[model samples]
Target: MTAERTRALQERFGNALMPTYGVPPVAIARGEGARVWDVDGRPYLDLIGGIAVSALGHGHPALVKAVADQTAALAHTSNLFLHEREVELAERLIALLGDPGARVFLANSGTEANEAALKLARKAAGPARPVLVATENGFHGRSLGALAVTGKESMRAPFGPYGTEVRFVPHGDAGALRAAVDDTVAAVIVEPVQGEAGVVPAPDGYLAAVREICDAAGAAFVLDEIQSGIGRTGHWFAHQAQGVRPDVLTLAKGLGGGLPIGACVGFGRYATAFAKGDHGSTFGGNPVAAAAALAVLDTVENEDLLGSAARTGAALAEGMRATGHPLVAGVRGTGLWLALVLTAERAAEVQARAADHGFLINAVAPDALRLAPPLTLTPEQAASFTGALPAILDEVNP
Candidate 1:
């Protein structure tokens, strides 16, 4: 059945589908908790969490109920009329961040949220402020506005002439950030933890320094928490761990559990920059999506998932490190977010071997394997991964 589905999918889709993603492998059918079953009924323990999007795992009762209830009530009313779920979700998010007055602009993905943030920053700065500063290895999104500010050349090269007035500063270098974000700059965007860059974290005082610099220069401080927010880092937002507040905060990824949703949150004076009708989305803040997100938030709070993530993540890291296998380089990250660096140049081989052993992980880079399991993961499941790691390393390293 699995082979038949794969064949049929390939034949029907063919080259008709965009080649952006590589050839597909197994066809996933259903999921529950941190486990997913393929068409062949093979179960794989998911550690990537759909690339950090599934906060409550596959099918949580609360999320299922919220989505069903809201859809039955009012799935979408268009941005023309305000909806109750949207208002409630916005209020919940604002209260979660301890910023009651923060205004929110909802979208469908992380990139769109970032696009809204960029526009809001530009509008706040007016026409005089032209330059926007971002960090090296920092990823915002794929839209032209977000892409223009992303630091990776490989991701940006295809779409040249994205726009004028954008600068890149070295990540974790506060002095370089200060020098780049001058009065002419409209905003300085950063990711508290560079998720795509092998789980690299910013240096101590980096965020605070950026906050100070942006405050001094009157530039908007925008933190793209798409991957690091929604309790991935054991915090509602990773920037909170640094004790810094950004003027513009973009969130998505895990926001909707498994559903699609995004938001650009503006604080203090920046919240008032976007006047009526300045920006909007047809599907943004759909009642169903908001309900899904609200369900995720409520589940996290009720389950004490944040504290569980921190405790389990630390144990997993410690267990992996205690292996002391020569092939194991180190472990770096916080909460449920982590990466296993390998001394061998065979991260891909390790991932394949792990799959053969009924585990799922991601080789985010050639030498780095990333793990972002669902916040609701059991301690036993986490320990199972760590126990199997040494053998996986042996198979690859041998």
Candidate 2:
């Protein structure tokens, strides 16, 4: 009966929804902690965490209460007036950035936040500098402005003529980056960890090199931490570990604990770049989202989830390596954001097999299964996944 219900729901979804994401195999009904239930009431251990957006997991009391309380009091202010939640959220973000002078522009998603940062870069560049430098295979967002600086060819191919002139360089090649940025460059945008390009991380001192180049070239150093930020990397922000700061930073994904929210922050003088009426969002920083974000932040600190993420992630990686499965090549990434690298391009098969075994993982690439599980994932839950992994891989390979 449940299978029939799931099939009927899938049919309805296919009939009603657009084909942007194709048809999902399972229709999720609800979730809690690191697991979710499908419409058929079947449970699956959720490791992707809604693409790293569900920081506190589904139905977290703090997030739920914050949203409910804020919605009851106030929901939308439209940026026409000031609201305390928005102000508080911005202040909290600046504090987390360790830059008291930084200013934030809240948006609904990473794409919109990137758009704002790109605009700030253009303004900072003025007319003399019009070129933007970005890393090859970097995925920023789908919007035209964000896509202009995004270095992925296939994503940018369909939408040509993305007005701004952009120079793409190798992801971690400092020499290539230095050669690309010159007097004509406005900003250099990159991700600390290239999440979309198969969970790859920047080499040591790479961010510092970018900072030095940007400083010499008088270009804004923009870090897009949409996926790597908000304690996903065991640090409040990924750049904190690098000992370098960016002139502008974009954040989203885990900030709102499943609510839609994003922020584009400008540091020092760049903080005042917008001036009067430069940019705005209708539902950006709605009270409920702000409250949800604040709750997430509070929970992170009170529960010390940063430490938890580090410990669990290390143990999980070690266990996967100990499995010594021939299909398993290695594990990459830090904290809860990881990719199980496989020897062959059987990630899709492995992902399907894992799902059949009551686990939900993302086949981010042909050979990489990305894990962006909730920070609340318990050690036992992680161990269960690791324990089941060998059998899953064997079922796929054998």
Candidate 3:
């Protein structure tokens, strides 16, 4: 994109939009597969995949047709009325979860899904359990309830006086998590892989330990899979590798392809937490969104994109590691959700340079470059990123 055009759009965005996001340098015109074009027609590889929401990639044919056909047939129907799409989607989700007894509560986004999960825990535990425990640096949604349970202080402190008493422990530390889980705990919410904290995975056996501790304490075990779920991490759910199941699972991000949708799933006794009229959403399970979700689920299974993501991600991470760049410290995380650890806090510079050379990546931390490209991203595209790595690094440190 031309500097003049980028500057003009930036100025326009600053004048018209809220300051929460400030202004992005590029104005995307359109996208196809894993590539997007700027307003001025410069193409760039989309490595972030809308922060792990675009599992099928840009303008996927099945997703497009599903959304379009469903919208044309039936778009919105509040929870007051039953819709076939919603029922079918629910059944599919339960089946995919490998828990036929699991109950699903759909929402508009990840935050709302997490909010609903929090309420479920609170309701199930009653007033007797007054505390919630989460891992330090674990990023849940920004809603008041989810934010309260979230471990990041800066994201929660500005809101002041959240109703829940949340305790934090060092992530991937089983002893710390066990110490925090007492009879007074309502729930222990954690992300299997810490997304915003530079793609940090839970230490092997850590999640299973938390599951055991929470079981002993009768605390709800809630896994917020908002970023790592829906085939991004080579599994339907990242915690599956631990061979344990969470009592409550919050999902979103890639649930509806590009459409906005989320779900809070409760299993076994936790399924009965919300009573009649206990909780609800007006547009949570819209027919169109459900249809889109069904399509995404179908595509993942039929096309075997999960295997592709796992194989491609492993190769990409290995190639990056072999590069031996001075900035490269190590590769952490798993499957498609991996990060390049840097010896110096120059992630922003690296990301900016990569984007300038037609690749979009996220600087998740001061020293970590996160990669969550679409599950459908080809191995060739992964190689392309590794091929361009040296120049990207040189441009940053030269």
Candidate 4:
């Protein structure tokens, strides 16, 4: 009977919603902790974590309270007036970045944060620098401005020319980055861990090398940490672990603990790139989102979820590796973010099998299954998924 409800909702979804995302098989009804229940009333362990956005997991009390209280108090003030929560959030993010002198511009999503970064870089470069360097296969956002820097050809093909010269180079090749960024370059944008490219991480010292190259070429170093930031990689920001600082940092995914909030932060001189009335957002740093973000930050610190994420992620990676299944090649990524690499391109089949067994994982690539469970995921919860893996793999048609 509940399955009929799921089917009915899906049918309605197909008719009402745009075809951009296609029809998902399961219709989620509600969630708590690291598990969610579909409309069919079937519980599934959530390993996807809303694509690494649910830092504290579903129905987290701190997040719930913050959002509730803030909404009840003052939801939207438009950008016309300033609010305390927004200022506090910006200050907290700058503190987390370890640069007290930095400045922040909040937006509604990662793409918008990145768009702000692009505008800052362009404004900084002015007419002298006309080129932007980005790594190949890098996924920033689908918006036209962010899409221009995004490395995927297929996604950018539909939009045609984006009125910007984006020079694409091989991922993790510092030499190529150096060759691309010269006096004519405005900025170089890259992700420490390329989340969409099957959770591929940059080689050791690659980010620091980019920083050096950008400094030498007088180009801004922009780090897109939308997926790898907010303790997903066991660090406040992935760049922090590398001991490399960026001129601009774009963040969103887990910043607000599932609330829609993104920030583009500028450090030192980059902070002054925008003059008065340079850029603004209508609902960017609304009080509710800022309050939600504060709660997430406070919870991460108070609960020591950063330590929890590191420990649980290690256990999950180790368990997956120890399974010794033939189809299982290896695991990639760090902290709570991970990807199970398969020997063959059968991730979709495995994902379906996993779903059948009351688990939810993402087939990020043909041969890669992404696992980004919440920071609150316990050892037992992780073990359950790992224990079920061999059986799930065995059932797949070879």
**lDDT of each residue in 1-398, candidate 4, tens digit only:** 33898999999999999999999977999999999999889999999999999999999999999999999989999989999999999999988888888999999999999999999999988999989999999999999999998899989999978999999998999999888888999999999989998999889999999999998999999999999999998888889899999999999989988899999999878898999899999999989999999999999999998899899999999999999999999999999999999999999999999999999999999999999988999999999999999999999844
What's the TM for model 4?
Answer: 0.99
Residue 6, candidate 4: C-alpha displacement in angstroms: 1.3
| Superposed model 3: Cα runs more than 4 Å off | none
Residue-by-residue lDDT tens digits, candidate 1, 1-398: 33676667665665687776665555678899999887667788999899899899998899999999988888888999998889998999999899888999989999999999999999999999989999888888888888898899999999989766788988999988877877899999999888888898888989999999999999999999999999988888998889999999999989999899999999998899999888999999999999999999999999999998899889888988998999989998999999998886788888888877778898887889999989998899999999988898888775
Where is model 4 poorest over a 10-residue stretch in terms of lDDT? Answer: 1-10
Q: Is candidate 2 or candidate 3 better by lDDT?
A: 2
TM-score of each: 0.97, 0.98, 0.98, 0.99
lDDT of 2 by residue, 203-291 (tens): 99999999999999999999999999999989999999999999999999999989999999999878998877889999998899899
- Deviation (Å) of 242 in candidate 4: 0.4
Model 3 residue 316 CA deviation (Å) reads 1.0
Worst 10 residues of 3 by lDDT: 1-10
Instruction: Give the candidates in order of lDDT, highest first.
Output: 4, 2, 3, 1
Q: Which parts of model 2 have CA positions greater than 4 angstroms off?
A: none
**lDDT, candidate 3, 1-398, per-residue tens:** 35767778888889999998767867888999998998878898898989999989999999999999999999998989989998898898898889998999999999999999989999999999989998899899887888887788888899969977889999989898888889999999999989999999877888888889999999999999999898888888888867899999999998888899999999988887799899999999998989999989999988998898899999989989988989899999778888999989999999989988999999999999999888889999999999999889988875
What is the overall TM-score of model 1 with all chains considered together?
Answer: 0.97
